[model samples]
Target: MSEVPEVRPPTVTPVRVVIALCLIAPFVAMLWVGSYARTGPEFIGIPFFYWYQMAWVLISTALTMTAYQLWQRDQRARAARKDGASK
Candidate 1:
């Protein structure tokens, strides 16, 4: 049988880093906004602190979706490599 060429999967560190940043950025922003609650006016009819935290709910969802996509891609690549090796 012909030897199957070794397939090197793309590095996932960057994807993980991006996901981490996505998760962290909103949290940091929320904290900053919360700190302003002692002084700042309401945001979009809601309290600054409340809206800030609520904003993160959507951001977290998006970040989770991104992470999931990255994981799925990695899995598909691994599966393809295995399939190739068995051929």
Candidate 2:
């Protein structure tokens, strides 16, 4: 009887770490309310708290885009590796 080899998950890479950070940074910043709860700083009469959240809306979009791009790159690299290994 032949034994089947176990397939292990890929190890974490620096690219993956950066991708994770890109995805998680917005959540962390938004969830950590106390950090931006005050409204002392005003921009064009807008309170800091409101403006900060609004700013994050754009920031989150950019981060999400970056994460998506990184994820696609990682997937392509993994696929190439897998194909090479199988060849």
Candidate 3:
């Protein structure tokens, strides 16, 4: 009877850390509501709180894209390593 080897998850690299941060940014921003809960600073009459969330919408989009790119690179690297190991 042959035993099957367990497949471990890929190791985290510096690039992956950056991707994690990029994904976490929006959650951190919205969670810390006190920082932007104000009206004095307005963009075209939009309240700070409202504008802040809206701004995060765009920022989150960019960050998500960056994170996704990083993830793709990591996956490619892992796949290459797996292929090389199997040969």
**TM-score for each of the candidates:** 0.60, 0.84, 0.83
Q: Write the per-residue lDDT of candidate 3 for residues 1-87, one digit (tens) a residue.
A: 996685666577788899999999999999997899888688999888899999999999999999999899889888887887677
Q: Which whole-number lDDT from 0 to 100 does residue 75 have in model 2?
A: 91
RMSD of each: 3.8, 2.5, 3.2
* Rank order (by TM-score, best first): 2, 3, 1
Q: Pick the candidate with the highest TM-score.
A: 2
In candidate 1, which residue ranges exceed 4 Å CA deviation?
Answer: 1-12, 20-39
| Model 3 misplacement above 4 A | 1-10
Compose the digit string of candidate 1's lDDT tens values, residues 11-54: 65676677677667766766674465652467867766667677
lDDT for model 3 comes to 0.89
Better of 2 and 3 by TM-score: 2
Error of 2 at 76 (Å): 0.5
- The Cα error of candidate 3 at residue 5, in Å, is 11
Evaluated at residue 84, the lDDT of candidate 1 is 81
Q: Indicate the residue-level lDDT of 65 in model 2.
A: 97
